[model samples]
Target: MPKESSQRGPTADRLHRVVVIVDENSNPFELGCTTEVFGLRRPELGRELYDFRLCSPAPLTSMRDGFFTLTGVAGLEAADSADTLIVPNRPDVEVPRRPAVLDAVRRAHARGARLVGLCSGAFTLAEAGVLDGRRATAHWQWADAFRSRFPAVRLEPDVLFVDDGDILTAAGSSAALDLGLHLVRRDHGAEVANSVSRRLVFAAHRDGGQRQFVERPLPDLPDESLGPVLAWAQERLDAPLTVADLAARAAVSPATLHRRFRAQLGTTPLAWLRGERMALACRLIERGESRMDVVARRSGLGTAANLRLAMRRERGVSPSAYRRRFGPRVA
Candidate 1:
């Protein structure tokens, strides 16, 4: 997570600052995603997670197709104070972004602030030249045009999003919510992220590498939604569940289950189960589970060594380090 900028002023002791750069012709859906995920006060969690605001090059920015006019937002100078700066999301990729907006993105990157480009917002980041040689993803429909316009960017057209350290990009409008929840999870831990997801009525975690578009958009069978099986497995995380167990629960063969998982979740059954276990482990740690054996056993990870390895691989940090960062602390 990026540190809050010194420009936070009296709110310096508050949560991380998130500023959205709303340009002319911006997509309202992605803008709503940022607001729903990061702007709302989380009274359920006893406090808010982010100090969120919106900024634009002008006071009255017109949304895509003139559906609405957004007004009363801060000016471009607000971008310098953002810990995470979200670039403009515009469908008209052919039009050039405001030079001020591009400069704000570049300044944010130079200051080590986290940068986010949702959907066609990648075009703005690319135009700023900050995304040169960096892995990014835009809306699949614009993939070819993006590549042609910016050959320097390593475009991952198929993935839902790409998290390249301080910079993140989502492929489509809906994927912006996925990336927002991911940012929360990375900064505040899984428990907090899950709370935010429940409020938004969204899946807590969708792996960034998941395909933006599933070939089978809907399940062929009415019972193949995977929701029931996933809930059952989550309830039994302490049990040694396998793919066969999941298949049996779903009343399908192993191969059928594999295909269904791929179609519905864009991931294998084993990977999803493992990810759930890791998430459980993270939640346990965040809640002050000091004993490694207890956390491992409760999360169905088997042993301390397995927990350590899994934490390192998935979080890029050891279990102890994770605890220090998110665990309950003494006053």
Candidate 2:
């Protein structure tokens, strides 16, 4: 976590009211994914989570699904009252750089509210100018287009998500879940996030970039040992890997391994392992690996029923649907 916020203030204890701005040509997946992570109540985890409002810029914004429409529910003012604002995916026509919406996002950000853009939601933030020179990400398919359209934004296409402290972003679709879980862990604690992840059955964490797992895999060599560890762990994910088990292969003591990971990866051994396993499940699902039993054993997540339970809560996709379309891409 960042310790450099000089403008320290009182921490509010109210359940975070996260308002998501729904658009006409919005991705119901991304919008719902946002709510799943933030809006849903997690009492078993024992933390104040959020109050979600699926708001639209207008009083009765419309949503399209081939040839149907659903009421947008809340208005932009609802978004204005949000503790955190989410833009799922913009219309297929053109990503809007709405002055009104942009002003709301900026004001919310300035007031210390976290703003998130999932997939093309990045388009909204970039246009609002909040992403100027700041590290951000979008779906791999749109990486080139996003860069061409908004050069001021430093678009990192390979990572699952970018956590620039107050402002955060993720690649399209399911990577949104990764960012959401990251926030949960950041705000609450490892135990809480882990529990939430368990309920969602989503990868509590991921391994290498979505690139390595994508159809067009990236090279393996890098200036880091974590990748090797990640790959090694994936192959033997079924094995109960201890910190010492991982540390020995890395040629470092358990304490040293923990220290190095904290400095570089910002997490501990067990946490990283869980993330890697979850990521593998995501990959398998994308590659038409739908059998929960196979995905669970292969990804080292556990069982088919467990996978179903987890996906329903966190990833917000059925095993069947996940196999159909991958949300996050590591291009």
Candidate 3:
């Protein structure tokens, strides 16, 4: 378990009303993610943090997986009074959204309600035009199609999620849970979010901009794949590892290592190494380590200057700022 932060405080005073918009053939896992985060009662707090409601275009709807049907759902008008409006994954993104749904989403944003999209639900937000000129993300599988349809939105497909202030967009099914916990962390502080995470058996916080876990096609010959070599490199992140070193560890020539890395990880050896080092630095920062030099050395990033440059280039934030947002706070 991680240490509790001392800077815990309510982000807002009043109970927040959250409304989830369900469309026909909605994804149950996405809806359940929202419900699990906002709908549950937290007696530990002595008061509810969110008043969660489910509203759909219709009162009854069947889910996409065809295993469950939802009933007692409120109409679109229910969203009119919500503090946050969430859209879960739909059956398709290419299909046009209902005008009524678009209008409600636009109106909610115009009235200052926070808007969220889980997975392909980002398509609906894009259709509503609320995502225009804003940074957002969706499941990586739909990256090309999403870009083709909505060229105006700056889509970052690699990320777990994107929090562009009032509009939050999550990448895929599991990313929805990350975004949901993020909302809790944003509204009720880390202590409460961590408590909720423990109950849910989920990671309390994953930086939204962290890269998605992409699946790669591996070679049939296990020896040809670089999995073991990658693991070895990970264990030696603090060491001055090189392409030649990696090649030696894998018992392959540097040229062969390059080919295998491209085929397996879709990146160069040095680039992948940098990404791993940056990820390690982020974890160290989140754990409340304040010494930049120590963090850089531990992560094999070399110096405080290099860490700052890498963080800025990759994560768009300074080390101190990242720590302030994620590190354990002292009283």
Candidate 4:
């Protein structure tokens, strides 16, 4: 989807409404993910991005594994007014979702509101029949069960998340944050998403296609974290950086660096670098940089043609089209 500007200082009705359904046995982690991503006040942006709220079928809801009892939120009708409705996650995937919850999801989809499923929340979506013939993901541990239960749904079980136009799904716990940040990036542009990510101290961009897990044995020697190298590369994205350069900076061979990147970030170094450059390009575009060549140069994409290719390849839109969608408005 093309990026959309977070209309700064918009009226109440203009703000995007994000409502989360806190169902019985729902997980709190994803609830916190939604709250942190869409519900919080962005004083840093000098505005709030969404008119966020929580809703439930009943006044008292039990959290996953009996963590706690949640109460005093809006009713399920709150979801009807939402621009995005986040379905709840529960650990027990075998158990069926409430009929009312499924109906709410169906209605939300019928009304053209965005639907999100985090972790086992995919089960809710599948149970609701909205995921039929749709690409979706759930925690890898339940891949067999999900495939067995929803034979019609295209389940991409290994990735972190799947964004199928109006509907999105994330695999497992931490991926909820990945999908949430993705939504922010989709709705408000890269700069705003990065700001929110920095505030949360989380990685701003994790490709939804990245693997959910890496099965690597523990290192015999002391583990060399990739944090410093990644930070260094991010600070100098405009420079001509190669795998050798990154390996040299990290005091490791290119092969070793590749393994570490896969284990830690679940993506290749080059892929990560390209993603960062594209994000920088988006930020530049969003800041009203009119010249495509300038955006390409500063973002280390080399040329305007390469910029357009990258934008179209990764963002599914041309640079000019993205700029038109998300660029600053004239007073």
* Top TM-score prediction, candidate number: 1
**Which of candidates 1 and 2 reaches a greater lDDT?**
1
Task: Assess every candidate by TM-score.
Answer: 0.93, 0.62, 0.67, 0.91
Name the candidate that leads on lDDT.
1
> In model 3, where do residues sit more than 4 Å from their true spots?
1-19, 32-54, 72-85, 111-119, 133-220
lDDT by residue for model 4 (1-331), tens: 3122223222446788888999989988889888988888888898778999999999999898887999889999998887888998898888888899899999888777888899999999999998888899999999999999999999998899998878889996789999988988887788888999999999889999999997565778586789899999999999999999999999999999999999888899999999999999999999999999999999999999999998999887899888877799788
Q: What is the lDDT for 111 in model 3?
A: 80
What lDDT tens digits, residue by residue, belong to model 3 across residues 1-331? 1112222223445568889998788888898899899999988766687888999888778888677788888988998978888975786778788889999999988787888899998999999988889889999889999999999999999989988878889987789999998888766545667778998998666667666774455557455767688889999899999999999998989998887776655567888888778878877887778999999999999999999999988655799977877677679
The lDDT per prediction is 0.89, 0.69, 0.82, 0.88
Q: Kindly list the per-residue Cα lDDT of model 2 for residues 1-331, writing each as its tens digit.
A: 3212222111455566777887666777777677678777777855456666887766655554644455738667787676667864664626465577778888777676777788788888887777888888887778888888889888888777877756778876678788888777555433556677888898676532433123322467444456677667768987767899998888779997776676566567877776666656766665555577998888766788877776665444576666544423346
lDDT by residue for model 1 (1-331), tens: 3233333211436678999999999999999999999899888998778889999999899899999999999999999989889999888899998888888999998887888899998999999998888899999999999999999999999999998877889997779999999988888889889999999998889999898988564546465578899999999999999999999999999999999898888999999989999999999999988999999999999999999999999987899999987788769
Order the numbered candidates by lDDT, best leading.
1, 4, 3, 2
Models ranked on TM-score: 1, 4, 3, 2
Q: What is the Å distance of residue 283 in model 4 from its true position? A: 1.4
